[model samples]
Target chain A: MSFLEVRDLSVRLKGGGPLLRNVSLTVAAGEVRGLVGESGAGKSMIGKAILGILPRSVEISSGAIVLDGTDLLTLPPAMRRQRVGATCALIPQDPLTALNPSRRIGPQITDRLVDILGWKRAEAEARARALLHEVQIADPDRVLRQYPHELSGGMRQRILIASAFAAEPRLIVADEPTTALDVTVQKQILKLIAGLQARHGTALLFVTHDLGVVSKVCQSLSVLYSGKVVEDTDVARFFAGPAHPYSAALLAATPKYTDPTAGLNPVPEAVIAAVRAEVENG
Target chain B: MTLVRTLLLRLMTTAVTLFGVAVIVFFVIRVVPGNPVAMMLPPGATAEDVARLTALYGLDKSIPQQFVIWGAGVLHGDFGTSITLRQPVLALVLGRLPATLELSVLALVMAVLMGGAAALTGTRLRETRVEGGIDVANGMALSVPDFLWGLVLILVFGVLLPVFQISGRVTPSLHLPFVTNFYLVESLVRLRFDLTRDLLAHMFLPAFALAIPLAAIIGQLLKQSLKETMHLDYVTLARTQGYSEARVIWREALPNAILPTLTLVGVQFTFLIGGTVIIERLFSYEGLGNMAIDAVINRDLPLIQGIVILFAVIFTGVNLVVDLTYAALNPRLRHG
Candidate 1:
């Protein structure tokens, strides 16, 4: 059964225009699904919708965000937050800025547990320490006392990963979590997230632009374009042959390391025009 | 270097600043085309009488020579005698210092409370009509100067309602039990509610008049900072963690947002203290600022110089405290 389902969900700029157009996707428990798209494709918006942290400039205009058995859009604000908090967490992009600079790492991680879940301080600290270890951070005890600026980018990302998993939420939204890290650190972080997702048996809504990352970690994939889901399929067959022309172009556009002599193939303007027309027409 | 070293460095800088203020104020007031001795002289007095008075006060000496003599007296804790008051400038300035401090500190506290409330309200209700109203209100407060605010406050609270003590520091007729001029603090410490109430009643209008525009300034800066902080990635991460909007704002966003606002408050405080000149005179309160206006009218060079030096000291002193506070709030500085 799907642990979280977004059905015909539409988000619009307040009294303006649609930001997300009838978008829908799902993640079953223990399944890792990559949300693939270019910039402004509403990939991260889906993750934000699930987590209910969309910017104030936009509002969820229609449809249902069903987490477990409940439709979150129908619930009151407080109840919805409580439900989301109990079941979902986000591994945000930009690790440096994702940790509060003024606060210590320990409280930033333990806060969700202690404040929201009413977990005892000691219990939350213990969980945080263990989660840090799970995320491959060393000297968890020392790290907890340190400020965000005191740590490196990789270390900060690890701390953020640890924070996201502190509550052991059923669903984790990785919103381009490795985008701001060094190239070397990116692989390690990706590996750590994939391992943690497997070990915890958590449903993962992994949002990213990199198809290579999806090839490594995701079981299923959703290809997005202009707030619409162009294609949704299992990762293996989708990689083997993307059903949509835009998806094929996106794949082709990604530089292949296997053939370094082959130059980068930019996504064709013809393909983009057709996709834009199709999405706008709908 | 250690904190001690840093503190010693700041103190040295402070001393240099005070010395600069002393030199500048003493020389500038002399060059203002007014003779202190002439101001002191009775009408129809001869040039010989004026010359005698000038020589007696050491004002007849060369300007630079007079500065050296005054600087020496300052080193020995003698700020020279006030020509107008015929008393030690140090004693007179010191006598008025606490009254100014008490008023300034009370006004500062009020501003912080009012500004904090305004900022929190605006931030909580951002992009709404209420936030827009607060911004407009803040602009209104900022556009009007403190003296205008003082007059408006007096007209509304003092004359119209007739509820508060509009002028003076306390009920002068009552036998005061205060050992210090810090009546507000001393009375509260002594559990003297009646004295405290009476003092606050007198201080309330003046302090609030000073506070309104200051509070508005702080509110606008802090609200803008808070709005920016709310958009940062950490704040978004905080929201994703399932924390309530209040917790995300108060706990996560506020700490980061308050840093810049705190610095502004610190710098604004120096200006706030300087602002007491017009405020104190308008209120008829006995403060250094009120004394400063009197000295300037009489061209009492020593008294004016003394007041200016004291103002400089307070400004630099507040800036030092702010730097230390900024360090405490920012962990990066604290650990580094």
Candidate 2:
């Protein structure tokens, strides 16, 4: 079995139509798998489902999110909570809002470490300092005492990364972790995440709309369209030549910085319609 | 040092606010068409007697001069004397001050505890029939004013059940050992649990009456703020971190949500003090509100001004505390 496998996962509003339909994907140990799609293509929903943090309105209708051969969907709630931060962590998007504004940076990072890992305060503080250093933050002590608003965006994202990795979980679901950051900070953050994953041998499910980001950090890519995974392939093949029609259209639509005069190609309505029909048929 | 600086600044602001209120109250009382001298004089008294009474009370001076004299005396903690009550205004106000303070404080405590619990429950049970029921009840409570609440309490608990005392701080015949503070505290300090019980029994109806409206206001504010805060990104982050629903609500959402409610709490407290007028009169509770009304009826200018100034001081002091609390609760506001 893979390190984390989501099989036939489906999510829908409590009394409404499906928001995610029969999506399946896997990330092997130490591998970084990217889930790339447009804004409403259910990319984040899959991540939320894995962490079991979907909004009250939405529920997983049919699915087994098996992490390390355990079906998380069937686990009791208390056990599920135990498994979430200890085995699986999420590096959320929008660092400004993701951390509690009223809390100091130190406690926000150390709370999960103490709560999930059952570490003593002294041990957690030591580990937190080390995590901050690992995330390349200088002056960890000063950063620890500061509130979220006191830090710059890059600093906040870095602190969030430290927090996500604090428990040394086996899998980290990074949902557009660098999307809100500037290009320079984005590259640094992506590199930091990759370096941390490599050092920890932690698997990652990286969700984003930016294909360039996927190319830089992801090893394999899953192309989603209208609540379905249209293509799941290695990163090299996805960039060199896509297998699915929707994937091909998505690749075509991406603006290449190397080819400045290559005008952006918007995905045609016909391609979207064809993909939707294919998804609905089976 | 910063906290101290912030406190000092707040104190300065409070001083300026009290001064402004004193000026307004002094002039406003003077402008009201009445003569304290006429009220004090007997029916058969001549013009000479009226003039002598006016000079005696310093009403013969210019308005600003009278204010300066009153203001100076106020700085020395002297509120002159009530013309009708035949006592120092300061002494009368202070005598009734503890009762008002006790009632107001108890009512405020009850409001916060009940409102906070109701809000927490409402948010947790949101979108359910229970929440809907709570919303209806809160609406009904808010619709009725505190005086009406007092009357209703008197009718139900006092007249019908007859379980609790309807009026007064304590039974007239039962005077316990009096210490400096209100009866409850004095009783507690003296280890007089019997008197404490009696005092509490007498206090229950009036305090509950004053609390219902304030509680409704606070609960509504808390519920709305908590709902909005629960939708914030940090709440989701807290959930993802495996914090339980209760923890997320109390730890993650509450600090942020409660900041807005602090201002409302302060304003509501001042409202409660103002509300004590009708509540005290209806219940025959000897509080500052009752005295202020009596002063108004008798056209007691010194007494009226003293009570207004005291209310303004309490109002300003409450606002200052609220501002400091806001700074303490929210780190963003702390430094700025």
Candidate 3:
């Protein structure tokens, strides 16, 4: 069995129709799997559902999220809560908003260690400093004492990365972690995340809209279109050539640096309609 | 350095506000169609006596002159004398200030505690039948005015139940130490638990009556803000960090949600002071509000002007404190 398995997942709005349909995917131990899609493709929703943090209005109509042989959906809420951060963690997008503005960096980073793992205050502080250093943050002591608003956006994102890794979680769900960052900072943060994930031998479910990011960081990729996975294949195979029509359209739509004069190509209307019909019929 | 600059600027603003309040109060009380001398004199008093008394209180002078004289006197802590009470207006206001302060503080505390509890409970039960009930109850509370609540409380607790005294800060017979003249504190200082209990018994109805509407307003604001704050990214991040639901709600969401509520609390504090007039009258509790009402009725110009200026100062002071609190709670404001 894979380390994390999302089998036949379906999510629906409270009063509205389905938001995510029968989506299935898997991640082997220490492997980085990417979920690539446009906005409203239910990529973030899947990440939230796996972490059991979906908004109140959204419900998993049918699905089972299995982590380490345990069905997360079947566990009691308290047990699931305890499992979060210890067994699975998340590096959220929009780092500027992800950290609590009212809180200082150190306590926020060490909260899981102190609150969930019940570590000593001094020990947690030490580990927090070490985590910050591991994320390549200089002057960890000053960073810890400062509030979220006091730090730059990249610094805040780095701190979030450190916090996500503080518990040495078995799985990390990174949902567009570098989307809000500048180009230079984005590359550094992505490299840091990839390096840390590899060093810890941790599984990662990377969700992003940028196919370029997926090509660089993800080993295997799942191309999602309109709430459905149109293609699931190795990253190398996906980059070389796509198997599914929607996947080919997505690659075609992505802007290539090699062809500077080639203005972006919009996905054809017929392709989107076909993808939507496939999801509806299925 | 920024803190000092901010403090200095606030102090200058407060000074200007007080000066403006003094001028407005002095002129507005004079504009009202009532003569302090006419009210002071008995039925047999002569016109010359009225003139002399009017001149004595500086009412005979022009409005600007009267303002200047009153302003100068106020700067020296002299608010002239009350024509009806035949005491210094400052003395009369000071004597009653403690009672009003005590009542306002107690009412404010009650409002905060009650509102905070309601917000927590309502937010927890949001999207349920119970939340609907809480909303309806809050709506009803907010709709009823403070004085009406005071009358209802008097009818129930005072008349029907007879569980508490109908009026006054303490029983006339129970004279605890007069350390601060605040019955509760005086009782405590004197170590008289009996008097303390009596004071609380008398204070309950009035404070509760003043608190109900304010609590409803605060509770509704807090509930709405908390619901929104819970959906914020940081709150979700807290949950994913393995913090329990309680921690997410209180530690993560409450801090952000409570900022707006703090401003409301400051506003409601001024309401408490204003509401105390009717509340004190209903309970026959002698506080600044009751004194102001008497000053208005008796046409005591000095007393009325003095009370109005005092209230204005209080309102401005409360707002200043609220701004300072905002700075303390928000680091962005602190640095800016």
Candidate 4:
């Protein structure tokens, strides 16, 4: 069985429209699956629903988030939390806002282990220090004592990544983790995440708008648009050529280093309309 | 080092602020058509007698000269003597200050507890009917002023049920070992639960009246803050840690949420202190507010000046404490 399988999931606002439309995806152990889409494509919602952190505004209408052979939807809320917490974690979008500014870095990273895992404070702290070291953070002791505001954006993201990996979680949903960093810092963070995933052999559901990032790190790619998965293909198959016209338009839209002049092509209106109609039809 | 500098700077600003309040009060009071000397004299008193009394109290001098003399006296820890009471103005104000302080403290505690509970309840039950109910309650509580609430409380707790002492700080008949003016603190320290209960019986109505609006303000602001903080990324991250919603709200969201509320409460508290005058009068409570009213009615210039200055000192002191507290609660401020 896949390490993480989201089967026929659907989510909608409490009294409003749908946010995710019958989404389904899987990530086998030690694999990276890039969920790529535009801003409002509900790429993040899939991750949120799987992790049971959907906002109060939205509710999962029908979904089964099967993590490590257990269907989370079938479990009670407390048990679902326990199951998810034990096996899965998230690396969020904005590093600056993701670490509570009022808190010290040490406690923010160590809290999951202490609170959810019921580890001793000493053990958690030691683990946090080692995790920080593994993330290539210099002077882990001083960094631990510092507040989020004291660290740079890159530094905060690194801490978050380290925190996500600290518990040895089997699956981590990287929700556009590098989107908030500088272009230079983004490469370093991406490399670090990919390196850690390889070393830990954890399944990763990488959510991003950057197809270039997918080509670099993802083994497989799923192109999502307007709360629906439009295309799902392996990295080689996806890059060598895409079968879906929407996927082709999306790849064309991403600026390439080899063909800089062809870079800024807006995804064709025809393709978006056709795909949007297809989504509405079902 | 920054904190010391901040306090020293705050103290300097406070001195300047008090001087400004003194100047305004001295000149403004003199501008008012009434003369304390005329007010003091009986109906049969002659003009010569008024002049003599005015000169005796140094009210015959120019307003600035009078201020300099009063200011010098104040610098020497003397606020002259009250024209109406025939006592040192400084002594009277100090004597009445602690009662107001104790009442204000009780009101603040009550506000925080009641308001915090309402805010937490509203935040926890957001998008639900309960949250809407809390919002409505907060609005109702805030719309009415404290003195009006005092009257309502008196009507309910005093006149109708008559369960609490609605007029005084403690029972008149209770033989009390009163070492300090802080009856509440002293009673608790002495383990005088009976005395404490009696004092609370008297204090409860007035304190609750004062707290109701402040509680509403706190509830509204804190709940709004909590809602905003709930949408913040850190809170979402906290939830993804597999902690319960309550745990996330309390630990992750509340600290940030409480900051704005603290600022509002700090500013509102000074207004609360100033508000005590009408409240004290409504309840016939022995506080500085009651004295302030009497001082104003009698045109007791020296006493009024003294009371206003004391009020100014308390205001500045509360602001200082608030700033220090903000620093302590916020890690950026503490470490920076």
RMSD of each: 1.8, 2.1, 1.9, 1.8
Ten residues in a row with the worst lDDT in model 2 chain B? B174-183
Worst 10 residues of 3 chain B by lDDT: B174-183
Misplaced by over 4 Å in model 1 are B46-51
- TM-score (0 to 1) of chain B, per candidate? 0.97, 0.94, 0.96, 0.98
| Tens digits of per-residue lDDT for model 2, A152-226 | 999999999998888888899999999899988999999999999899998999999989889888999899987
- Compose the digit string of candidate 1's lDDT tens values, residues A69-185: 899988999899889988898888988888889989999888789888999999999999999888877799999999989899999988888888888889999999888999999
Where does candidate 2 stray beyond 4 Å? B1-13, B31-34, B40-42, B46-48, B60-65
Docking class for model 2 is medium
Indicate the docking level reached by candidate 3: medium
DockQ class, candidate 4: medium
List DockQ, one per candidate, in order.
0.81, 0.72, 0.72, 0.79
lDDT of 4 by residue, A148-214 (tens): 9989999999999999999999999999999989999999999999999999999999999999899
* Global Cα lDDT for candidate 1: 0.90
lDDT of 3 by residue, B1-336 (tens): 988888899899989988888877777878879877887679989889988887887778899888888788888999988888889988888888888888888899899999889898888888998889889989999999999999999999988999988788888986566766677777787788988888889898899999999999989999999999998888998888777777788999998899999998998899888999889998999899998999899888889988988888888889889989998998778777
**Predicted candidate 4: interface RMSD?**
0.8
Q: Residue B3's C-alpha lDDT in candidate 1?
A: 82
Candidate 3, residue A42: the lDDT equals 94
Best by lDDT: 4
- Could you tell me which 10 consecutive residues in candidate 1 chain B have the lowest summed lDDT? B238-247
Colliding residue pairs in candidate 4: none
Q: Provide the global lDDT of candidate 4 against the true structure.
A: 0.92
Better of 3 and 4 by DockQ: 4
